[model samples]
Target: MITNETKENYNQCQNVNCSTTFVSHETVARYIIKPQLINVLIPNG
Candidate 1:
Protein backbone atom coordinates (compact mmCIF):
# COMPACT_ATOMS: atom_id res chain seq x y z
CA MET A 1 0.00 0.00 0.00
CA ILE A 2 1.18 3.51 -0.85
CA THR A 3 0.37 6.64 1.09
CA ASN A 4 0.03 10.00 -0.64
CA GLU A 5 0.63 12.08 2.46
CA THR A 6 4.08 10.63 3.22
CA LYS A 7 4.81 9.11 -0.19
CA GLU A 8 5.87 5.82 1.31
CA ASN A 9 5.22 2.21 0.52
CA TYR A 10 4.13 -0.24 3.18
CA ASN A 11 4.90 -3.91 2.86
CA GLN A 12 3.71 -6.66 5.14
CA CYS A 13 4.57 -10.31 5.36
CA GLN A 14 1.80 -12.75 4.55
CA ASN A 15 2.95 -15.21 7.18
CA VAL A 16 0.77 -14.91 10.24
CA ASN A 17 3.51 -16.27 12.49
CA CYS A 18 6.04 -13.67 11.40
CA SER A 19 3.74 -10.77 10.56
CA THR A 20 6.74 -8.60 9.73
CA THR A 21 5.98 -5.16 8.34
CA PHE A 22 8.34 -2.91 6.42
CA VAL A 23 7.96 0.66 5.23
CA SER A 24 9.87 2.13 2.26
CA HIS A 25 10.18 5.83 1.69
CA GLU A 26 10.00 7.07 -1.88
CA THR A 27 11.86 10.09 -3.17
CA VAL A 28 12.78 11.70 -6.48
CA ALA A 29 16.38 12.74 -7.18
CA ARG A 30 17.02 16.07 -8.82
CA TYR A 31 19.70 16.15 -11.50
CA ILE A 32 22.65 18.15 -10.23
CA ILE A 33 24.50 17.83 -13.53
CA LYS A 34 22.52 17.22 -16.69
CA PRO A 35 23.68 14.75 -19.33
CA GLN A 36 26.40 16.07 -21.56
CA LEU A 37 26.83 15.37 -25.28
CA ILE A 38 29.52 12.82 -26.09
CA ASN A 39 31.80 13.05 -29.12
CA VAL A 40 33.01 9.81 -30.74
CA LEU A 41 35.96 9.77 -33.14
CA ILE A 42 36.38 6.92 -35.65
CA PRO A 43 39.73 5.87 -37.05
CA ASN A 44 40.14 5.55 -40.86
CA GLY A 45 40.46 1.90 -41.94
Candidate 2:
Protein backbone atom coordinates (compact mmCIF):
# COMPACT_ATOMS: atom_id res chain seq x y z
CA MET A 1 0.00 0.00 0.00
CA ILE A 2 3.03 2.24 0.12
CA THR A 3 4.95 3.64 -2.83
CA ASN A 4 7.79 5.99 -3.65
CA GLU A 5 6.19 9.06 -5.17
CA THR A 6 5.90 12.71 -4.35
CA LYS A 7 3.25 15.13 -5.57
CA GLU A 8 3.60 17.88 -3.06
CA ASN A 9 5.95 20.79 -3.58
CA TYR A 10 8.69 21.00 -0.98
CA ASN A 11 12.28 22.14 -0.61
CA GLN A 12 14.41 19.05 -1.15
CA CYS A 13 17.85 18.15 0.03
CA GLN A 14 20.19 18.86 -2.83
CA ASN A 15 23.31 17.86 -0.82
CA VAL A 16 24.77 21.17 -1.95
CA ASN A 17 24.04 23.20 1.15
CA CYS A 18 23.27 20.30 3.46
CA SER A 19 20.69 22.51 5.20
CA THR A 20 18.86 19.54 6.69
CA THR A 21 21.79 18.78 8.93
CA PHE A 22 20.76 21.76 11.04
CA VAL A 23 17.20 20.52 11.54
CA SER A 24 15.88 17.40 13.25
CA HIS A 25 13.69 14.89 11.40
CA GLU A 26 10.79 15.36 13.82
CA THR A 27 10.77 19.08 13.05
CA VAL A 28 10.91 18.39 9.34
CA ALA A 29 8.08 15.83 9.50
CA ARG A 30 5.87 18.24 11.39
CA TYR A 31 6.69 20.99 8.92
CA ILE A 32 5.56 18.79 6.03
CA ILE A 33 2.88 16.56 7.54
CA LYS A 34 1.17 19.17 9.71
CA PRO A 35 0.21 21.35 6.77
CA GLN A 36 -1.18 18.36 4.88
CA LEU A 37 -3.17 17.26 7.92
CA ILE A 38 -4.63 20.75 8.30
CA ASN A 39 -5.76 20.73 4.69
CA VAL A 40 -7.36 17.30 5.08
CA LEU A 41 -9.11 18.40 8.24
CA ILE A 42 -10.34 21.57 6.54
CA PRO A 43 -11.21 20.25 3.12
CA ASN A 44 -13.72 23.06 2.62
CA GLY A 45 -10.92 25.54 2.04
Candidate 3:
Protein backbone atom coordinates (compact mmCIF):
# COMPACT_ATOMS: atom_id res chain seq x y z
CA MET A 1 0.00 0.00 0.00
CA ILE A 2 1.15 3.51 -0.79
CA THR A 3 1.46 5.40 2.49
CA ASN A 4 2.59 8.89 3.44
CA GLU A 5 5.17 7.45 5.85
CA THR A 6 7.03 5.60 3.11
CA LYS A 7 6.76 8.58 0.79
CA GLU A 8 8.31 10.84 3.39
CA ASN A 9 11.23 8.48 3.97
CA TYR A 10 12.01 7.73 0.33
CA ASN A 11 10.85 10.94 -1.34
CA GLN A 12 12.37 13.35 1.10
CA CYS A 13 14.22 16.41 -0.30
CA GLN A 14 17.38 18.20 0.83
CA ASN A 15 20.20 20.43 -0.39
CA VAL A 16 23.56 18.80 -1.19
CA ASN A 17 25.47 22.06 -0.99
CA CYS A 18 25.15 25.71 0.00
CA SER A 19 22.96 26.44 -3.01
CA THR A 20 19.32 27.26 -2.37
CA THR A 21 17.81 24.22 -3.98
CA PHE A 22 16.13 20.92 -3.19
CA VAL A 23 16.69 17.33 -4.35
CA SER A 24 15.00 13.97 -3.84
CA HIS A 25 16.61 10.97 -2.13
CA GLU A 26 16.07 8.91 -5.29
CA THR A 27 18.76 11.03 -6.98
CA VAL A 28 21.42 9.89 -4.56
CA ALA A 29 20.10 6.33 -4.51
CA ARG A 30 21.23 5.86 -8.11
CA TYR A 31 24.83 6.56 -7.09
CA ILE A 32 24.77 4.63 -3.79
CA ILE A 33 22.90 1.42 -4.67
CA LYS A 34 25.53 -0.72 -6.41
CA PRO A 35 27.66 -3.87 -6.01
CA GLN A 36 31.20 -3.53 -4.65
CA LEU A 37 34.00 -5.69 -3.18
CA ILE A 38 34.72 -5.10 0.52
CA ASN A 39 37.60 -7.46 1.35
CA VAL A 40 41.09 -7.00 -0.18
CA LEU A 41 44.55 -8.59 0.23
CA ILE A 42 47.35 -6.63 1.86
CA PRO A 43 50.66 -6.15 0.00
CA ASN A 44 52.80 -6.31 3.16
CA GLY A 45 54.25 -9.74 4.14
Candidate 4:
Protein backbone atom coordinates (compact mmCIF):
# COMPACT_ATOMS: atom_id res chain seq x y z
CA MET A 1 0.00 0.00 0.00
CA ILE A 2 1.06 3.63 -0.46
CA THR A 3 0.47 6.59 1.75
CA ASN A 4 1.14 10.25 1.03
CA GLU A 5 3.28 10.94 4.06
CA THR A 6 6.77 10.22 2.96
CA LYS A 7 9.35 12.94 3.20
CA GLU A 8 12.27 11.28 1.44
CA ASN A 9 12.73 7.91 -0.18
CA TYR A 10 15.92 6.42 -1.52
CA ASN A 11 15.38 4.03 -4.40
CA GLN A 12 19.02 3.72 -5.26
CA CYS A 13 20.03 0.08 -5.36
CA GLN A 14 22.26 -1.58 -2.83
CA ASN A 15 25.01 -1.72 -5.42
CA VAL A 16 27.97 -0.35 -3.53
CA ASN A 17 29.72 -0.22 -6.91
CA CYS A 18 26.83 1.79 -8.34
CA SER A 19 29.38 4.71 -8.50
CA THR A 20 26.68 7.33 -7.97
CA THR A 21 23.79 7.69 -5.57
CA PHE A 22 21.39 8.69 -8.37
CA VAL A 23 22.14 8.00 -12.03
CA SER A 24 19.84 9.57 -14.59
CA HIS A 25 22.20 9.43 -17.52
CA GLU A 26 21.43 6.14 -19.26
CA THR A 27 18.54 4.29 -17.65
CA VAL A 28 15.04 5.45 -16.74
CA ALA A 29 13.98 5.61 -13.12
CA ARG A 30 10.41 4.84 -12.01
CA TYR A 31 9.72 5.84 -8.47
CA ILE A 32 7.28 3.70 -6.43
CA ILE A 33 6.41 4.51 -2.89
CA LYS A 34 4.95 1.85 -0.63
CA PRO A 35 3.88 1.59 2.94
CA GLN A 36 7.37 0.89 4.23
CA LEU A 37 9.63 0.77 1.23
CA ILE A 38 10.53 2.64 -1.92
CA ASN A 39 11.08 1.01 -5.29
CA VAL A 40 12.72 2.31 -8.45
CA LEU A 41 13.51 0.93 -11.83
CA ILE A 42 17.14 0.12 -12.50
CA PRO A 43 19.07 -1.21 -15.47
CA ASN A 44 19.38 -4.98 -15.59
CA GLY A 45 22.96 -4.65 -16.63
lDDT of each: 0.76, 0.40, 0.43, 0.50
- Candidate 3, residue 45: CA error in Å? 2.9
Best prediction by lDDT: 1
Candidate that scores best on TM-score:
1
lDDT of 3 by residue, 1-45 (tens): 134222322332355664454433322323446668888878997
* Cα RMSD (angstroms) for every candidate in the order listed: 7.1, 10.8, 9.7, 16.1
What clash count does candidate 4 reach? 0
**Which one wins by lDDT: 3 or 4?**
4
Scanning candidate 3 in windows of ten residues, the lowest lDDT window is 1-10
Q: By descending lDDT, how would the candidates be arranged? A: 1, 4, 3, 2
TM-score of each: 0.36, 0.14, 0.19, 0.19
Candidate scoring better on TM-score of 1 and 3: 1
lDDT of 1 by residue, 1-45 (tens): 254334777899999999999988876556678779989899999
RMSD versus native structure for model 2:
10.8
lDDT of 4 by residue, 1-45 (tens): 133432343357677888356533333255585357668889998
C-alpha lDDT of residue 42 in model 1: 96
- Worst 10-residue lDDT window for candidate 1 reads 1-10
Model 3, C-alpha of 29: deviation from truth (Å):
4.7
User: What's the lDDT for residue 42 in model 3?
Assistant: 89
Model 2: per-residue Cα lDDT over 1-45, one tens digit each: 122332333365778868453432222222444334344354675
Question: Which lDDT value does model 3 have at 39?
Answer: 88
